[model samples]
Target: MRLFGYARVSTSQQSLDIQIRALREAGVKTNRIFTDKASGSSVDREGLELLRMKVEEGDVILVKKLDRLGRDTADMIQLIKEFDAQGIAVRFIDDGISTDGEMGKMVVTILSAVAEAERRRIFERTNEGRYEAKLNGVKFGRKRSIDRHNVLSLHQAGIGATEIARKLKIARSTVYKILEEMKVT
Candidate 1:
């Protein structure tokens, strides 16, 4: 049976060194390891897709941790079930869980659920903090690239949207959007 390894990080700035080292120490060859610098919530990861295509029946997939495999509980459960049906086993080294037996499957499910719950909690807390900040008059989102007042003055001075956009180095759509907002206000 072929052995494959997968590693992931939520952001591009995060390092995969530890996971790679762990996978290598587990006897997974360097060439057989797939890594993605992406969020676990995203299923469109190129590395993960390639790994899925490469694995065959009787092949085993190894991950450093269960949460590293996926953050969504349903997705994680579905993946494990799919692998199990295809005669493939998934081993999570840090969690010490394997999808090789009923007990291991059960534990993985529970842990996945807990991880998903924690993710939801973090989401809720972040939204709460954002709401509180908004209430306190803190602004969010990207700063305005062009000055609204300048756009209005330029429009009042008979400057066309295209001319304003060209002068400001912004899109014509942005010039029109600013003029529209000024009309409403």
Candidate 2:
């Protein structure tokens, strides 16, 4: 039987030693270990893809945590379902549950629900912030600093756009844009 281990860290600086050791201690072969440093926020991971390609029926896929699989529940569930479709079992080291067992499926389901809840909460909070900003008369975009007075004054003084931009320490295109905004030729 072939067992493949998958390990992920949010950044390359973080160590994958813990997961590697845990998987090896769990009886996975050293040559079968696949480790990477990538964000768990999404499923578009290179390491995950490599594991998917190599995994076959009855293969065991190991990880450290549920979140190491994904940041959202749907993504986590999708990952599990992919393993399910391939008949590959997911063994979480920390949780000590293997998808090949009934208890493991229950744990994965619970964790997936929690992840979905967190994502929904974040979405609501973001919407509330935007709404509050609008109600408080606070602009929710980049502030406009076209310098209307300077542009109009310089243009009225018969200054060329290029020279005006140099004087203002801005770009020539910025001068032209200002002129356009001011309805000046």
State every prediction's TM-score relative to the real structure.
Answer: 0.59, 0.67
Q: What is the C-alpha lDDT of each candidate?
A: 0.88, 0.82
Q: What lDDT is obtained when candidate 2 is compared to the true structure?
A: 0.82
Determine the C-alpha RMSD for candidate 2 after optimal superposition of all C-alphas: 5.6
lDDT of 2 by residue, 1-185 (tens): 58888888989899999889988998888888887688887788888888888989988888877677776667888789778777788978897767776776786677668767878998999999999989999886788766779877988999988888888888899888878877878
Best by lDDT: 1
Best candidate, TM-score: 2
List clashing residue pairs in candidate 2: none
lDDT of 1 by residue, 1-185 (tens): 98899999999999999999999999999999999998888677899889989999989999999888887776777688778878889999998888877786686678668767877998999999999999999999898777899989888888888998999999999988888888832
State the RMSD for candidate 1.
6.6
In model 1, which range of ten residues has the least summed lDDT?
107-116
Model 1 lDDT, residue 43, Cα: 74
TM-score of 1: 0.59
Candidate 1's displacement at residue 51, Å, is: 0.7
